[model samples]
Target: MTLVARIRALPADLDDLAGAAAAEGFGMLGVLAREWVAGTQRFAMPEEALFAARDGAGVLLGIGGVTRDPWAPALRMRRFYVRPPARGRGIGRALVAAALDHARGAGAAMVRLRAPAAAARFWEGCGFRPIDDPTATHGLEWPGRG
Candidate 1:
């Protein structure tokens, strides 16, 4: 399936995607949903926040997005999800690639994200190494793995 990403500026079609992502093995899905709602509201009223994802046949197959960062030249990939029906097909991996491309265009120097322990091995296959920092969490680096 084709993967794409768009701005979270409208948030008109995210509630469903959030629910689907929550069903995955990711533990931070709850927090991600809460933040997405808040960010969606903010994005609607403001112009700073951004969200992007991959849509397949009018359904959210994958999700990856970022908010405006004033602190540094980096984008925190707040959430990444692949629907159950869309899993095991490398959709998650494609979505991550799309998200990283978006972040780079937003003038971000680095992109950070969290992956569930269950998916850690998968991310490793994506070339992400665990950092020494406790707060660093989980993420896969690009062009290093695969």
Candidate 2:
């Protein structure tokens, strides 16, 4: 059966999701947790926000966030991860769509991310193209932004 996920702005809790990500050898989620607890990098900057996807049973399926790039005046997509079991369920794509929509709504003309080598195809499939920029490995410009 296909599962439905509810995507929304992150809440104050994500320990379970962080643990799941660690089990799969992904440490970004743990960093997200620590930074969240420390009151740093909460994605609270203007035009920035974090998103979480939860299954019908309220289990975290994935997470992604957009923030202002520290080195460039552009939006950066970060801390994106989908639980292993939740792969192929459209959860990751949904998270990306949500983040992109948020970025566009906030007046961003483009979005960038440093995708891991293994995730190159996925990011490309999501409309991001590989780039040589130091601040990001891939970028996507909003259509008609010019």
Candidate 3:
């Protein structure tokens, strides 16, 4: 089935988004669960946005978000999770594209994400390069930035 993506606003979206993240082992440590709860609360702010991918039937297939970086003049991509059954179908790519578009519209100088090792290649494929840091997050400078 074809998947469509759009900005998400309902609290129910958070439940499904968090559940997808949890199913991907994010709940094992509980940090992501807490972040999902806290992050969604801030989504209405001018600096943040949440998105959901849904099938033609309107069943959610994936979710993600972007927010202004508190520590840098950049946008931070967060909570990107695609259901296992929906992986390999470009949902993640679509989500990242939407987030980057939002960042550019917000005048961000760059975009950053602390992706897990398992997702390193995926983020790289999305045009992010490893940042020189102990934690090894990925970053992408806004296009045309010298």
TM-scores of the models, in the order given: 0.66, 0.88, 0.81
RMSD of 3: 3.1
Q: Of the pair 1 and 2, which is ahead by TM-score?
A: 2
In candidate 1, residue 116 scores what lDDT? 60
Which lDDT tens digits does candidate 3 get at residues 1-146?
65545564544555665666677677522443455567634456575787778888877887777876666777788778887888999998999998888777777778888888899999999999999855339999966752
**Model 2's TM-score against the true structure:** 0.88
- Candidate 3, residue 66: the lDDT equals 84
List candidate 2 segments past 4 Å from native. Answer: 1-13, 143-146
lDDT of 2 by residue, 1-146 (tens): 32433334354557778788788788998887778778888888878888778787767678888988887778999999888898998888888998898899889888999988999999999999999987689999987773
lDDT agreement with native, every candidate:
0.56, 0.82, 0.74
Which is better, 1 or 3, measured by lDDT?
3
Q: How does model 2 fare in lDDT?
A: 0.82
Give the per-residue lDDT of model 1 (tens digit) for 1-146: 56465564435566677676656545444565565567642423232333444555666566655544344344555556666877788777776666566655545555555556776777667666665545555543344322
In model 1, the Cα lDDT at residue 128 comes to: 63
Q: Report the error of model 3 at residue 17, Å.
A: 4.7
Local error of candidate 1 at 2, Å?
2.0
